[model samples]
Target chain A: MDWNKILLFSILVMVHVPIVSIGQEKLAMQWENVPEEIVQGRLEPQGTASFQRFPQELQKEVREPVWQLSRNSAGLYIDFESDASDIIVEYDVEDQFSFPHMPATGVSGLDLYAMDENSGWQWVRGIYSFKDTISYRYNGIKPAIKGSLRTFRLYLPLYNTVRSLRIGVAENSIFKPIKTKEQNPIVVYGTSIVQGACASRPGLAWTSILGRYIDKPVVNLGFSGNGKLEPEVIDFILRASPSIIVLDCMPNFRDSQKAEESIIKSIERIRAANDTVPILLIEHAGYSDGFVQNERLEIYENLNKATQRAFTYLKSQGINFLHLVKKEDINLGKESFVDGTHPNDHGMVGYAMAISKALTEKEILD
Target chain B: MDWNKILLFSILVMVHVPIVSIGQEKLAMQWENVPEEIVQGRLEPQGTASFQRFPQELQKEVREPVWQLSRNSAGLYIDFESDASDIIVEYDVEDQFSFPHMPATGVSGLDLYAMDENSGWQWVRGIYSFKDTISYRYNGIKPAIKGSLRTFRLYLPLYNTVRSLRIGVAENSIFKPIKTKEQNPIVVYGTSIVQGACASRPGLAWTSILGRYIDKPVVNLGFSGNGKLEPEVIDFILRASPSIIVLDCMPNFRDSQKAEESIIKSIERIRAANDTVPILLIEHAGYSDGFVQNERLEIYENLNKATQRAFTYLKSQGINFLHLVKKEDINLGKESFVDGTHPNDHGMVGYAMAISKALTEKEILD
Candidate 1:
C-alpha cells in the first residue's frame, strides 16, 4: 500500500513537473513573425510566479480546452501603436458556437476598437465568422484618432476557443506594444453565464464589463455547466491566488443536491489553503419568469435556500471578510434572461453593475 | 377633381367595409364543431365595437403587416376553463426565427401555461415550430390544478405572425373563457422594444409585464424601427381612445432629426384629436454599452437631448397632463440590449419596471 501511494505521488509529480517548470513563467506560445516583441495586454505573464492553474496535459484533457484557455485572456485587452493604414490579425480556433442570432463578431471571434480623437474608442473591425477552425484573419481600418500612433483594443470571443493568435500592422509600418499597470486579478468562477453564454459579442459579457468598469485584469473561471463545486476545479482556482474570488456556481447544481455541503467544503478547502483573500458568494439569479411560473419560483427558492444556508454556515465559521451577493441586487427578473437560462448582453450589464457595486462596497476594488 | 376624390373615398370605404362591420365584436372564428365553446383566452374580441386600430385592408398594406396585425393583441391574454386531462392548441404562423439562442416557443409559436394546485402557474407545452402557413397543433399535459377544471393563459409570439389560434381539452372536457374587469387600456407607442423583440417569451416583455402588474389592457403600437413619429400610426392609436398614451419613440429618430419637433407635433396632433388623454414621454433607455463606446454615448445623448427639448416645449405649451420619463428611470445601459439596439427579455423587464413606477407615480395606472 505504501508503494502504491508512493507511485501515485510520483505520477502526480511527473504530471505537474512540466507545468511547474514553466512555473510562473510566461505563457508558452510559438511567437508569430509579427506582434514583434511583447504580448500586449497580457496580465502578469506567469513569469516565474507560478500563475497557470492547470497543467498542459489537463488543458489538453478538458472537453473544451478553449473554456480553460479562453477565460485566461477574456478581459486582457491589448494596446498597440501602428502607423499602417490598417491592422491585421490571425488566429487558430478549436471550437465555435455558431449561434445564428448572435453574430460571429460577438461569438467565437475578435472585435477591434481604436481610441479616436473626438469619438473616443470606436469600433474598428471584427472577425465576423467562426464557421471554420482555421485562422480568422481580419483587416481593420484606422479610426479618427490623432496621428499615426494609435491604441487598439480587441475582444476575444465569449464562448469559444483560440488555439493561437497573432496581430500586426500592414507590412512596412511602425508598430509598438503597450501594457497597463497590473491590478489585482479578479477571478470569477461559475457556470456558463459567467463563461458568457449568448452575449452578442465577447466584450459584452458581465465579466468583461466588470473588467472595463473597474479597470482590472479579470480571470474568468466559468466552466459552463460544469461549475458544480468540484474540489478539483477549486484546487485549480487556488493556484491563481486572486485578490478576490467569486463563486457563482449555483446554476450548475441540482435542487435535490445540497449546494450547501459542496459550498461549505469548497470554502473550507480554499480558506485552509490561503487566508485573507476575500470571497464573494453569488446566489443564482432566479429565473426571471419565476414571477408568474410557480414551478420556476419553487426551483429558484430551493436553489437560493441552499445558497443562504451555505452563507449562514460560512458566517458561523468566523469568516468576517466574506461577502454575499443576493439575487435581488442582480435585479434579474422577468426579462433579464435569454431562453430562460442564459443572460444576453442586457443581463450581462446588470450582472456586471451589481457585482461592481458589491465589490466596491467590500473595498475589494479599492 | 371633386368627383375623383369622392370615388377614391368610396373605394377606400368599400375596402374597409368588412373590418368596420366587425365592429368591436368578439373575434370572428368558425366556432367549430366541439372544441366546445369560446376561444379560451381572447378579451372583448372586437365584438362589433371597432377596437381594431386599422381596417384589415389597411393592415395588409403596411411595410410589415405582421408588425401591425401582431401588435393588435400584443399585450392581450386570456383566462379559460378546461376539464380534460390535457390541452391541445392549434395556430397558423407566417415566419419563424429559428435562431439557436431564441426558443421556438418564444419566437413564432404559442406557449400554454396552466395554474397548478400548489405550484400557482406551470408551463404545460409550447407549439415550437412554424413552417409554411399551415396549422400547428400542440398537446400539453395538465398541471396539478384542483379538480378537473383548469385555467390556462397563453402568450403570443413576439416577432411572428399569428393568423389564428385555438385551444381545446379532451373530447368530453369543459371550456369557458374568463374576461377581466374592464380597466382603462394603456396604449404604448415606441420601437421594436415596445413591440416585444427578443423577449424570451411574449409574456416577459415590459409591456406584457405592465399588463399583468396593472391588470389592465394595453395597446402596443411599436413598429420595430418604424416608430419615428409617423403621423399615420398616431392616427390609428387615437382610434383606441386610451386613457393614457405613452410615446417612447425617441430611439427611432436619426441624430440629425429633432425628436422634439416630432414629439411636440405628435402631442399636438393627439391632443387635438383627444384633449384629456394623459401623455407620457419617455427618453431612450441609453444604450447599455454606451459607457465604454463613446460613439454610442453621443448617439444616446443626442437623442435624449431632443426628447428633453420636446418635454420642455410641451410644458411651455401648458400641457399639464404631459409627464416625462428620464433615461435614468429606464436604467438601460450596455448590458440591456439584444444586439446593441433592441431590448432582450431582460431589458424589457427593466424598461417595464421603470415605466410602471413612473406611470404609477403619475396616477396613470390608478
Candidate 2:
C-alpha cells in the first residue's frame, strides 16, 4: 500500500474540515427546519433519498456516474420570508471542499438574496465559516420598509451534496417558508456550465440569473460532464411538466455523429412523452482557445452543423414547438471563459442573457 | 504547548506540497530563462531584491505588511515572441494554495495570451497541474501564417509570491523576449481589488483587461489591505515616471475622515515629486450588500463624499492635471460582486471599461 498517498489524502481532508467558531458576541436565536416543499429547482423533491435532484426509484435505472452526480444540490434553493434583522444559516455538505478551477464559494458556499420593495432583488452578504458544519452569519439586514418582513431567497451549493440544513432567525421573529405553486417551470438540461462550473457564487449561475430576470422558477437538471442526452435523464426531465424545455448537451459530444444521434433521440423521446411542449436546442458556445487551435474550433463548428442537420430532419417529421439557438446567438467573447472551456461569471452572464433573449423572442416568457 | 494545533498545521503544509509529475509522452525541449527587463507591472525591475515590485532600498522604509505584500506577483506578466507550436511553463509560488473565496487558479495559477495577426489578442488555454513545482502544458498552437512567430504574453500568479519560473519550447523553435521601451506607463496604486484579488485568473484582472484594451503597459502597485496612501508607498509611485497616476484606495479606508486626510496627503506627496503627471482619483465602488444593508451603503457614500471633498480641496489650491472619478462612473450593479465586497471576473470587466473610459475622456490614452 502507498502510505504516502494515503497520508497526503487524509491530511487534505483534515485541513478542509474547518472548525466552526462563533465570535464573542453570540446573538440569541430560534432555529427552524427548512421545509422540503419550499425548495425550488428540483424535479422530484418529495421522493428524493435526501436533498438531492433524482428520485429514489431512478437510482438503479441510471448510469453509476449519473446517479452519483444526481446527489449534488445544483440549482436547488430555499425560499422564505423573514422579519429578523440578523439571520444565521447552518448546513452540512457531503463532498470535498473545492476544485482547481472553481472555489469553495461556488462549490459548497450558500448565497442569500432578498427581494427589495422598490429595487427588485438584492444580494445579502454574510460572514461564513466552514467546518464539519458550515455556518453563515448575516448581521443587521435592513428591512424592505421600516418594520416589515421581507422575502429572502437562499441559493444552495452548485457542485456539492447537502447532507443537512437549517436556518436561525432572531428570537420571536417571524420566519415562514414560501411554498411554490405547481407552475410549469423553464427546465434547463445541459452540461457543467449550466451546473455552475466556475461561478464565484451560486446566484451568478446562468440558471439562477435567468430565474431572477424572468421572475419564474428554473429547474436546473445540469450534470457535470455527464449531460449526455440519455433516455433515463430525459425521462426525469419530462416529469417536471416544463413550460420551456432547453437541451444544451452538444459540448458533451466529442464528435458530430454522437451529437446528431443524441439530439434526434432526445427530442424524439421528449415529443413522444409530450407532443406540444416547447423545446429549445442550443449549439455549443465555441471555446475561447478555438482562435489559436484549429481542432478546438472544429469541435464546435461540426457539432453545430450536426445540430442543424438534426433540426432539419426533425422538421421533416412534422415536429413543432422546436427552436434552435445558434453559436452566434450566445456570442461569448475570447475573454468570457476561465479556462477556455467553462464560462466564468462573465460568460455565465452571457449565457443567461442569451437564453433570456431567445425565450423572450419566442414569446415563451413575457 | 498546543500539540493538536501543531499537528494540524504540519499536516496542512505537507498536503499542499504537490508532487511534480510529467506525462508519459514527454517531448524533448529546451528551456529559456525569463528576462527580468521584459517583466511588466513592477514599479522597478532592475534594482529589486528579487523579481518584486519594490526596490531593495525601501525594504525598511515601508510598513511590515506593505513590504511583505510587495513580494506578491499580482499584476506581473512576461512578454516574448515564439514560433513554437507547443509551450511549457513551470513555476513555484511561496504561499498557501488558495483562499475560501478565491481559487488556486487566481491565487497561484498562470495565464497565457497570444497576439492574433488579425483578431487582436487571443487567450491560449493550457492543461495545468499544481504541485510544489506547478506546470502548464499548451500544445498545438496555431500560427498567424504557416511559419510565423507570434507574440505571446504569460501572466504570473495574482496573490502568491513567485519563487522561480521557467519556459520551454520545441528544441529548434525561435524564442525572443520583447524589450519594453521606457514609455511612461499607467501606474495604478490602491487596495486589494487593484491587486487582482478574487479574479478567476490573472488575465481577467481589471488592470490586465485595461492593458489589452489600450494596448499599453500598466504597472500595478496594489497592496491588499495595506493601501493606506502612506507617504512611503506614494514615494515609490512618483519614481515610476507615470503617464497617469490612479488612486483607488477608498475601499481600504474604514472611515470618511481618514479617507479625506489620506487622499489629500497622498496627492500632495505625488505633486511635490512630479508636477505634470495626470492624476486620477477613484471613488469607492459601492458594495453589493448595500442594497439590504444601510451601514454598508453609507461606507461607500461617505468615502466617495470624502474623496470629492479632497478633490475639491486640491483643485482649489490651483492643482492642475487632477481628475476625480465619481462612484457612478464605475457602475457596479448588485450582481457584479462575488462576495458583495470583491468584484468577480464579470465585475472586473466593468471596472476595466470604466477606467478605460475615464482615461480616454481625459485624453490620457488614444
Candidate 3:
C-alpha cells in the first residue's frame, strides 16, 4: 500500500504490456504465413515439398519455418525470408531415409553456383563431410538477375536472389535416361511404405527404383499411414491422371472383410474414372511369425481368398487388373524383417526386385 | 459512499460465499482424482497415450490417456475399465496398410477364438459386410469379465493403426490361443509404408501377404515418413532378435548423399550387433516417364548406383545380403500408375507379382 510500492507495480505492469504485445505479434506473424494449402488435408497434384520427422525427444528442437515448392508456374521460391548470408539448405535426397541421427558418409556431393549475368554457371565438388548439413555461402552478394512471374522459369540473367539451385550427387543419383517412344507416369497409392518409408536412399525405394528403371517421372502420393481409400484422395488420383494406379492398402485393414470391400470400392471408383487404367492389387508382405498363429493364419487365408475373388470379379468385368499374391518366394521371415513388419535395406532391395520381376512378366513396362 | 449501498453489498457477498464454496468443492474433488504426476508432466508411459489421427482431417484431435510400458518390460499392455452390460473395446490395428484412407478390399477376413483357457484356438469367420469397417459383436449376455486381458496384437500394427482398429466385436467371444510354431516373431523397422499406409485391407499389404505365405508372424515397425535410419531403432531390432532384417528405408531418403551414407551405416550397425543375419536391400520402383524428366531420372541413377556399390562393399566384407533392382518391366506409362507415385489396385498386384517372382528366383523364400 506504500506510494513507492504502487509506483513500482505501475512500472512492472507497463513493462509487461510490450512483452505481451510482442508475443501476440509473433503469433500473428506465424498464423499469417502458414503452410500453403496444396490439397487442404492431402497433397495436391504436381505439388513439391519436403517433410521432416523428428524423434519424440527432439521433436521441438528442429525448426524448419520455410518450405519451397518447385512448380511449373514459377521457379523455386523461398516461402520464408531469411537474413542469414550463409544458409544451409538440407533435405532428404533419398525417398525414405530421412532420419536426423543417421547422416550420409563417404558419398559423392554436388555444389552448384550460378554467377552474375555475365559470368557463366560454375560447379564444384560438394563435400559430404558434414554429418547432417548441406550449405551454400553467397557472402551476401546479390546476383544481377531479373525476376519473372513464372514459377518454372529458370531465368539466370535476372537472378537477384538464389534462383535455379540444384544439387546432384553420384552415389545417390538415378540411372541414365532411356529414350522411349512413350512415357507414362506410375501412380503408387497405399501405406507409408508405398510412400517410401525407411529406405536408406531415395532411389532405393521400390517406387523410386522402378522410376529409375523406367526412366520416367513418378507421382509419389504415399502419405504416411493416412493412405486410406478416402473418396477425396481417389478424387486426387483421378485428377492426377497417371498411367497406372497401384492399390497397396492391406496393411492398414486388419479385417479381411473390410479390406476386400474397400478394394472393391476403390477399384470401382477408379474404373468409374477410367475403365482401362491398369489397377494392380498387392497383398500384404510377411510379418513376424510370432504374432500370427494358426487362427490368425486362417483369417489371413480368408482375406487372401477374398482378394482373389475380387481379382476374378474385376477380370470378369473386363477391367485391366493384376493380382500379386505372396508366394513362398517373396516371404520375409523373421530373419528378413528389420523389426517384424517393415523391411530393412536388404528387404527393400528384395521387394523391389520382386516388383520389377512382376512387371516384367506382365509386360507392363518397356 | 452510502450506508445503505455498503450494507447491501455486504449482504450480497455473504450470500455468494456458500454458492462459491460448493462450486469450488466440486472442482477440488475432480482435481483430487487427477494424479499429480500427470499435472506435472511426469506421467508413466502407460499414462500417456497418443492422440488419434482423424481420418478426414489427418490431424490429431484428442489424446486418449493410456498406460505405458514399464522399463525393461518385454511387451506393451493397455487396460480398459468398463462395467457396462455390453462392452466393445477398440484399438488401432497397424501394419494392415500403410495409410488409413486406403483399404484393401479384395482379401478375406480371419477370426480366431480361444476355446479354453490355455488350449489351442478355434477359427471363426470374419464377416466383411461393412465398408472399411471390421467389427465383431457379442451374442450372449454374461457377467463383466474382470481382469480378463485381450491383446489385439499384430506383427506390423503401426501402419494399420492410422485407420484400422482391433475391436471386441462380440461379448463372450472366446480368446484364441496362438500356436507356437506359427510364431515367427520378426521385428520390422522401416518408414510409414511398412507401417501400412494407404493399404486397402489387412491382408493385401505385402508384409501380411508374406506372413501368410511363410506361416510366420511379423512385427511391423513401419513409422510412415519418419522411417529414417536411426541407431536407436536398430538397437530395438537387435533386442527383438528377429531372424532376418529387411532394410527398406529408401523412398524416405530422397536422393541425398547423406542418405546413401546412412544406409550403409545402418546396415553396418545392425550387422555389428548381430552377424549372420540375412539382410536384404531393395531399390525404389522406377517412375513413369510422364511424372519425371531427364534431370530427376539422373538423380535416381545416382541413388541406384550407390545402393549397388554399398551392397557390393558389404558382400566384399562377407555380409549376407540381397538386392532388388528395379526391372525395366513396368514402364512409367499411363497404364501403370494411378497418380505419378501411388499405384492403384492393379499396380499393387503388379508389385506383388514382381516381388514374388524375384524372391522365387533368388531363393530367398521357400
- Candidate number with greatest DockQ: 2
Candidate 1, DockQ score (0 to 1): 0.11
True contacts kept of 2: 0.70
lDDT of each: 0.60, 0.84, 0.39
Query: Individual DockQ of the candidates?
Result: 0.11, 0.63, 0.02
**Winner by TM-score:** 2
| RMSD of candidates 1 onward, in order | 11.6, 7.1, 21.1
Give a tens-digit lDDT track for model 1, residues B29-98: 2221222122222223342112123344445445565335433434445567665443444455556543
Encode model 3's per-residue lDDT on A1-366: one tens digit a residue: 253344233222211111112212321111111122211112332232212111122223222211111111111112222222122222223222122111121011122232223422222111122223333222221222322111110111000112122221112112121122133556666665664443332333456556544544455555445556656556656765667676766665667777778778888888888867676677777453323233445555666676777777777877775555453445654323332344433445556667666766777664
Per-model TM-score on C-alpha atoms? 0.69, 0.93, 0.35
Name the regions of candidate 1 deviating beyond 4 angstroms: A1-55, A60-153, A162-184, A198-200, A255-261, A288-331, A344-347, A362-366, B1-55, B60-92, B96-152, B163-175, B179-184, B255-265, B283-320, B323-331
TM-score for candidate 2, residues paired by index: 0.93
Considering every candidate listed, which one attains the maximal lDDT? 2
* Residue A174 miss distance in model 2 (angstroms): 1.3
Task: Score residue B22 of candidate 1 by CA lDDT.
Answer: 19
Candidate 3 chain A lowest-lDDT run of ten: A150-159
| Comparing 1 and 2 on lDDT, the stronger one | 2
Over the full model, what C-alpha lDDT does candidate 3 score relative to the true structure?
Answer: 0.39
What TM-score does prediction 1 earn?
A: 0.69
Tell me how far the alpha carbon of residue B102 in candidate 1 is from the true structure, in angstroms, after superposition.
7.1
TM-score of chain A of 3: 0.54
